[model samples]
Target: HATHCPKPFYSSMKTQLVSAIHLQEVELDDIEGGNDPADDKKDPTYTVEEAVETIGFGRFHVLLFVIMGSANIVEAMEIMLLAVVSPEIRCEWRLEDWQVALVSTMVFLGFMLCGALSGYVADRYGRWKVVVAGFFWSAYFSFLTSYAPSYGWFIFLRSLVGCGVAGVSQGFVLKTEFIPARHRAYLLPLATIFWMLGSMLIIVLGMTVVPTYGWRWMIRLSVTPSVVLLFLFWFIPESARYNVSAGNTRAAMETLEWIARMNHATMPPGRLVESAQTERGSWRILLSPAFRRTSLLLWYTWFVASFSYYGSVLSSSELLEKNLLCITDADAEHRVKHRHEEGSVCYCIPFAFSDYQTLLISCLGEVALVPLNICLLNVVGRKLSLALLQFLSAIFFLLVNICTTMLGFTVLLFLLRALVSMNFNVVYIYTAEVYPTVARSLGMGFCTSFSRIGGMIAPFIAQVLMSRSVMYAMCPFAVASIVCALGNFLLPIETKGRALLVRLCPR
Candidate 1:
């Protein structure tokens, strides 16, 4: 300072002090490593579930939910077609009861043949590819079914439609992976409402078109949605979980990043984690000791669930036979008595129209179950909810045995359908939760194939038993419900409020 006396000296001294402070800050950042490039390259400390939760629910999830839910609509229509068109097809083809039942059987035959393979493919190749392929297969076959010239041709096309519809199972797994666990219980069941919607559509059309234009036109109309779904599915992405499970970290990262961007969220810096073991999915994995008990129980559950579900639906014709207002031979004669000479005058019972009406009533149970399921599942948990519903359904099914009047029968039918619908929702949600990511789709496929087994035989049960007595027709379904109720009580895994497991291999 004594030598400085000059202004230039003072300025130089100040600059030196600022530079020293800046260097000290740099040294501190190095010690903290906040700006270290190596830190950016480290694997993420968080899991996929954590990340998905961070991103949260938004348009991305809604798009997925709606698209997958629409897929459910096409599947619902296709599966229900056997019941909706059975009477018309039978009259037109002069089909025997066995043949009428066979129409329902063959569709599931197609499903049984292809369902496991579809699941494996989704697991190995990825979910989106199979889902799109399934859409195209279904659309083409569904449209083709309208032109079938004979019962054999009609059944063949329906089987093919089953194969196509199988994709929805995989689509369901993919959808589950995208959702945050917190919301799964609520949203997954809600998607099933589309099933109710699809069924209602079929009944509405059956009410209007089947009576006038015929069953063929009703089938043709069902094809439009599948075609629309093909376009929408193109916009969907593969599940990030599937990608990471498959070891394509880069692909998973990209998908997660896209999700983050869409969700207006931040991607944590680093790689996501999945089970390190990379064994390809195999059917055997589902039957391995660790999963063996779980697998057998699940299969049996699916069988009972499907048997009761489809048995009730496919037996609607027989149920309607008990309707107090059923068209009588004399009433039919009276309606056409004056027009005997008119070749177009018809004497057949208005089965197509009546079936449609009865099905509309069946849907009321489903509509009511929407809010009921939310409340019931939340309070009792999945295992208890399923058990309770199954037991309740058994009571309703047995009540059909003693019901002498149409009112009693209709009430029991409504109650039976409602319980079955609730049970169906619980089983599906539970199945998606118990299996690990490594074999989730395969497990679902394997279990679902057992459902097809039940579906395959249900028509026969209904055909023979319905012709005898109400008790005879309903005994098998009631028994199955009791078994399921017992099974639900015994299943150890309570999937409610649980995390999706990453690996299920033995420790």
Candidate 2:
């Protein structure tokens, strides 16, 4: 065969052999000179944080904010729906004050029970999994709640709905992981607009739908947002930080590449460096010496934020109800004289049109404060901003007790809602920033569960106590807010302009 080959072919073979020998000698010399071929082939590596920072905030984040913010809206509607429906539920069931209050309490009871568990699962399994499951769980149960034939079934289903909402918060954790640190202050507070919209939407439904179709139809309609969120779930990628922390470097890289493409940006020019995997959902780490003080103080702050915020929200209807009922001088005097009488006929009317209007107006307070909250977050920072909001909220809670005119009460309530909502926004941003990726979801879950404990107690004070005296209802919230303010001031670390921790300790 070699003899039959063309002379040019033989010449080419000889040239390739000589070139190969020369290349081998050069490579050997390079090896002997302590240069590595593998090193030459390797690209520089970047940490997940560095890659995310380079990707920066853009189109993907706005889409993420909307998707995750919609989850907040759904949760807000579910929670605010309780206050809107409680009056109707009370009238229909002929329930006592405490029983109606129990309806609200049970939802938070379920939330508190499942919040930490959901966090643990999100940390161990995946945030995207938990968030999607939560939406389905909540939507299914909320739909079933409209068909509840009796009080027992209604409360039971509502509690399960709360359980689902607990998991939905992982969406926020997921959103936080992706946001660039510089933009978090601006974007996180703005997310509260969705929550405010949800709150106002339920009130609008209460006014228009409940009067025309009744509360059942109102509930059926409330599930629409959750259903919509399920459709958008496809676009939400799992957190790249989480993927890196879980040691799934390829998945992390793929997600980052997708983010870069979506943002019209470029990823860092290297492989993603996987973080050392840590315990996925360790409660002990939160209580460890490093995070112990911050965790405890944060838990208390969460409790106060929920207690005061929900207390004001639930109490607003009752206060409005009283104002509506007492418009006539004779009726006002009669109510005061017979307020303590046993077996007295109770008026269990649903909120009037004007009452719903008032609620809607109050809901806007959160929106109006967004700009101010952003300023506080950026300028005053997390700790001082939180403390300032809480302190102002306490003052408003107290002012609500002293106000004599309905207009004055409404104004104070509006300001109070604005402050409490801002307080929640700050705490959420702070918590998401402070925890390491290894336990971010779990930490939020634990803190949220503590907040639910406050929610569990709020209805009693807001409904049962407000039914007796304004001071009784408002006093507890005022006290709690003051304590939370002090706790916020004492928080050990401020996360402003700080990078999120990947792990508590190097392994």
**Evaluated with TM-score, which candidate comes out highest?**
2
In model 2, the worst 10-residue window by lDDT is 325-334
Model 2 per-residue lDDT at 123? 89
What is the lDDT of every predicted structure here?
Answer: 0.78, 0.86
Off by over 4 Å in 1: 1-44, 275-277, 321-348, 352-355, 404-408
Report the lDDT tens digits of candidate 2 across residue range 1-507.
Answer: 779889999999989999999999988988776465676467487898899899999899989988899998999999999889987887888888788889989999989998999999998889999999999999999999999999999999999999999999888899999998898889999999999999998988888898789999999999998988899999999988888878888898899999999999998886666665768889988998889999999999999999988998988877765442223233332244313358574656566676787798899898888999999888888999988898999889887877355556567778989999999989999999998888899999999999999999998998888877877778899888888888777787888898888888412
Query: What TM-score does each of the candidates earn?
Result: 0.86, 0.90
- Residue pairs clashing, model 1: 44-271
lDDT of 1 by residue, 199-246 (tens): 888878778888899989999998888889889987788888888888
